[model samples]
Target chain A: MRVFRKQDEMTVKKLVTYLVLGFVGLFMLLPFLWMLSTSVKPASDVFTSFENPIKAFVPRETQWRNFPRVYDTTRAMGGGFARWYLNSVLVAVVVTLGQVTTSACAAYAFARLRFPGRDKLFLGYLATMMIPGAVTMIPNFILMRKITEWLTVVAPMVDWDASRVVSVFGRTYDAGRLVGLDSYFALAVPAMFSAYGTFMLRQYFLSIPRDLEEAATIDGCGLFRIFTTIILPLSKPALATLTIFTFMGNWQSFYWPLIVLTQDSMKTLPLGLLSFMGLYSTQWSLLMAGSMMMILPMIIVFLVGQKWFISGIQLGALKG
Target chain B: MAQTTRGRTALAGYLFLLPNLLGFLAFTLLPVLASLALSFYAWDLFTSPRFVGLHNFIALMRDRDFWYYAYNTVFLMLAIPVNILGSLLLAVVMNQKLRGIVVFRAMYFLPSIVAGVGTYLLWRWIYNPDYGLINTIIASWFPQWLSDGIRGLGVEWPPQWLTSVTWAKPALMFMSFWTVVGGYNMILYLAALQGVSPELYEAADIDGANAWQRFWAITWPMVSPTTFFVLTMSLIGGLQGGFEQAFVMTRGGPAGATTTISYYIYNHAFTWNHMGYAAAIAWVLFAVVFGVTLVNWRFGGRIVHY
Candidate 1:
């Protein structure tokens, strides 16, 4: 009787676990699988009935031309798709680098250094994260307009208040005003420092045991040396985790770049996608093609670096 | 390590923190305070802000679209528990002694890493009324189950998805599920699962506690802290309901069926450039989120085991 009960109980557990997991995995993966299928599928396969999952698996004709078209200028119009992609990459890279560096230095000080009102200051920093970005939109924009205007100081000299000069991209435009070269700095500079990263990293640092720091101090290590040699080495896992998330997020950023960048060459990926909608109309084929190109890089990164994402979140639990 | 001296190290810490401190104040703190003042005024993008007292707040109380977005946002919140449960289940399934679990997990998480716009575009195609993969398969064998007259035009022909009020909330909620269920929550649960003690399971096996009882008594409680965090984060994020999807998917369309509070605020601020009124909307959201979070914490304090 006991043996019978044991067998019955184990089977129920197994069944429950599988059903629960099956339902969830199916939901999470449906969208991505659908995308990959859409990218590679032909037109007939593009729209079947979504009510059923089976049609998604079948392909009618594989329209591969769409992928390359997403890269071409005729499709993109404002400029070459490659330039927009390149600009986005450059801006995201610069912004991510600046954010990590600035945040790390600040976090280190909050964690290891001594300063006045340290507790109060840290509290103040945490408080900042609660504020929504909408509050500062107009102010920041006005600030940027003023700054960008000042940057164009040379535009007047170039214009000579007389004539315009032609440049290599083959267009003769006013060299007149000091308008900046539609620079990436306008996007990257403002986003470089963040209160969020500081809060996350500072929390991670506090969880580290103090014994390691003491040992470094015993070795007559200077503050910077201790930071570089001890703290940084120990924080590798956390930093890597932050890098992936911040990189992915910034790479996908849209609104800020849209608001700040008026020049054609300055648009980021999300804005690039948004702009595509205006020219493409309702063409699903081309839109999917553009969407695929934009998403593929992030997919590749996440696939190769899945461990860090888990490690990053788990860090909270492990330390707690 | 010894908590150091009350001297130069502390001084250096302050110095190191200055950049971030200044940044937070300049960018975040000052704006929050300024927004409070904005909530009391009327201002446009071109003109200077004018103080008008609590008029914006009173206006918010009566605004129909504002209430509609709140109602829709509440509907989105209902999906949270479902999402959390679904993700936890996925984690448990993938966490098994199965082969190629890592790849499966990666595949599962793929949607989340992609840009939200990209995800929306892909889903839009899938949700198309005519040629969408979803309707196609369902239509072939089970005609009754499929929604009729799909244009095969994909989103050009999508079933008024995310745009029609009746279906907009559900569509947005479905997309939210598609976007995050497996990919977003799965990673966190998998982490929590790995931490569950094998010894406890072994002990439960020996103690005549059945698998069901073991899960209830041992596993469930162990994962409560993660559950609380996930719950809180989801509720908070759900309230905001990321603007990109609504902005792109519905544009608060079909008579504004899908606008969440965040999208409404975005419209007022960036679209209409109603800086003062937009600030007011933002404050209201902050209050709602803040208020809900406090309530969660108060209740959470009792049951969150970690």
Candidate 2:
């Protein structure tokens, strides 16, 4: 009788724990569920369910047209949905490529090479990470403006027309400018070099065995060749982590792009989405549809690379 | 010849570092120094900069918005402890051998991975006064007398969340906590919990310790280091936060109720063209962050168990 009582008590405790945890878990998912519900909700019927509390989570009739309508009309203004999507992809890809390539080279120098002031230089670089991005934001904005001004001043000397379109390497640009506000050059260049990327990669590089480099050197491989063949291939996991981080970060970046991209057409998706919010504040369905579109890529990436995403964060935390 | 080759190898290393070093100098290092100098000089982009030593700092002291924004910032930070503790509790619960727990963990972490702006937009709609997710529930399910009683006590029912000064900051904090409670912080805690030796728990169980006792004695101390890390990072992040969310949702407002120091700095520099004053605010923010980090290192290091 005593044993049975003990088992019953344990069962009750477990049951209660599960019930509490399940309730909390639902709350975690509540916002997303609400977002999806609102997206499919008809414009007229969106609020009708509010008369019933439990009914709020379910839509009376699903308006799947809401998603397509986002792209069909002027409500998708501020350079349209397509332009913003293209800009986001372009900036994220170029920024990721630049960040990874530069960080890898820097990490290689720090990890394997001996040179004067290397340690001191790296320490100085590490110290840059301590300075928050907000502090540097103003100066960088000023820097961008200064560069644009200089380009404008020198445009006449090169017979360049600032307002005219010019094409190079299948990419179009203003014939008059190299770096200016609302330009892709302004967006991609400043984001390329990352101290955190260099630090993370350098740690990974240090863990790689020295024997591979030594054997390559004996086989008459130059530094460049060794780095291309030996170092990079061996460090694919670290590279992937940095790539995803940089790409995701650039995709989601708001402040810098918001400040820099003054023209509607030049705006990235996140910045473009803000204009949609401001214009369509009353239309919750359209807003939800736009938001779902904005978040779709990230969700897909997270789902596919969930393993790397989780492990990479854990590695970063361990390093910190 | 060998010495010459050794020198050449060093040159190659330096060559490899040149591109990143140049970017660092131009973008990161130069801007840091320039911003520091700009803090003491007044310029509005069209005009030449003029030095005005300590004037900007003094002006900041008198600006009421600065103080209000500072308060808003600190008020937002009140959620940090709540976030850490909440995540810790969730992590402990998640460490159990429950079925479908992996799915539960994924569901919980989903919000954190989604883009920030989307999350904010979701909450903005949720906090809608008339038909929002929150107010809808309150309107239908909540007893009328309870709302009337609260109103009789001088508070409004189904509060105007983002638009009302009284509830804006708290609403933002709630959204932040909800997003972060199951985020990377929870994962860190979970990892730390898994690292704790099972032998200690077994020994405690042998001593007739209950679940609560086992957690308080063995689990808590074992996870203190992770707690320290989370606390420090969260504090740093908290102080610098509110810029993105405020800029998007509130634009720092219902009469500047949600203007954090970061948003204020952006407003001064970009919107008002008060570049010097903005730089001064930026420096002030940096100093506060640095000071808090120092305090955490000094105090947190001692209490954090290995």
Candidate 3:
């Protein structure tokens, strides 16, 4: 009788737990559902659906054109979304490539090779992570401005003012201004060498067996060749983890991009969306559509690389 | 182990490090030192810096807006416990050895990686008094009296959340909680929970300990290290939190209700062009973060079981 009573209590507890979890899960999922709902609702239906909350979740007629309208630069609602998308893609891709390359090279040194003051230098590098980013923002801004001024002085004295330099996307500077204000270089370059990436990669590299590298060295392979042939191939998971993180970070970066790229054409998606909010604060459907566009790539990436994302986070936790 | 070989290896190491070292020197280390120095000197971007020892810090103490923003920042950190505990509870639920748990975990973790600006904007829509999700849901679900009673207690009916001064900070805190309740914190806790040995629970069961006793004596102690880690990280992040949300949703307004130290610093540096003053604010923020971290390490470290 007592065992049956205990069994009944266990059933009750389990049911309550599941019920609570389901409710909280629904609450957590509501915003995404609402965002999707808002995206497809016609502009008039958006405000009207608010009268009935249930109707708000279900669009009267799905406006699929809202997605394309986001990219239509000619429309009042679509202000350079294509340009911003291109800029964001370019910056994220290039920055990820640069950061992974630099971090791997540096990690190889710190993890594998002997160096004077190596441990001390690494400690210093790690310590920099503790210094909050707010401390660096002002000084970096000043430095960027100084660089622009110095470039103006050193580069050919063009008759054109700095403001007239159309874009800073090209390798050749025949149009002048390689990295000043409104430049992709300014957007991507400062973010290319990550201390966290180097640290994580070093930890990963240290876990690799020394026997493989020693054998490669005996085979007349130089350090660069060994790194490229052996370590790079071996550390695919680590590289993928770092690449996904760096790309997502750069893609969604707001403040630095906002500071550097004042021109409309140079704005990344997040910055573009910020301006979109300012201009169309009341247009809920349009704003939702724009945001959906902004976040779609991130969601896709997360879905595709969900395993790496979870493991990467778990790895960082282990380091801590 | 050979000296000559060590010397050659060191050269090779330096060659590998040169690119990152140069970038780090130019970007991070030098700028960090420069920021400290710049806090002492007054400079607009167009003008030369003027040496003004401790003037910025002194001015900050006198600035009413700075104090208000600082208060707002500290107030928003009230959500830290909410976020930490909510994530812990969810992690407990998630740690159950059940079928299809990964899908639920993934759903919970989704909001965290969804773009920050997008999340903020979504919340902005949700907090809208007239047509927002929160208001609409409340109005539809709750009877008239409850809503009226809530308003009688002096909240705006359907709460002008981000727009109201009293409600804005709480609204922002709510958003922070929503973001983290199933995020990396939960994942960390889940990871920590998985590491707890089954033997501890089995031993407790053999000893006739109840579920609550088992949790407190075994599960709690086992997860304390993760708790400590989450606490430290959350506190540091909480201090720096309001800038992005406020920048997107509030712009530090409805009368600077959501203004935070980070936001204030950004404004002073960029919008106002008070670089020295901004650096001073940044330093103060750093000092607070550093002090809090130190305290957590000193006190909280004792309780954490590795």
TM-score of each: 0.85, 0.95, 0.94
Task: Give the per-residue lDDT digits (tens) of candidate 1, residues A131-228.
Answer: 55655655665455555445447454443222234476887432222322244555777677788788778888787898988987788877778878
Ranking by lDDT: 2, 3, 1
Top model by TM-score, which number? 2
Clashing pairs in 2: none
Per-residue C-alpha lDDT of model 3 across residues B237-281, encoded as one tens digit per residue: 878768888999889998998999999999999998999999998
Best by DockQ: 3
Q: How accurate locally is residue A145 in candidate 3, as Cα lDDT from 0 to 100? A: 67
Count of clashes, each model: 31, 0, 0
Worst 10 residues of 3 chain B by lDDT: B94-103
True contacts kept of each: 0.67, 0.63, 0.68
Worst 10 residues of 1 chain B by lDDT: B149-158
Ranked by DockQ from best down, the candidates are 3, 2, 1
- Lowest lDDT sum, 10 consecutive residues, model 2 chain B, at B107-116
Clash pairs for candidate 3 = none
Per-residue lDDT over B134-177 for candidate 1, one digit per residue giving the tens place of the 0 to 100 score? 55654565444233434342322324565455666777777777
Q: List candidate 2 segments past 4 Å from native.
A: A1-14, A75-78, A158-177
Q: Alpha-carbon error at B39 in model 3, in Å?
A: 0.4
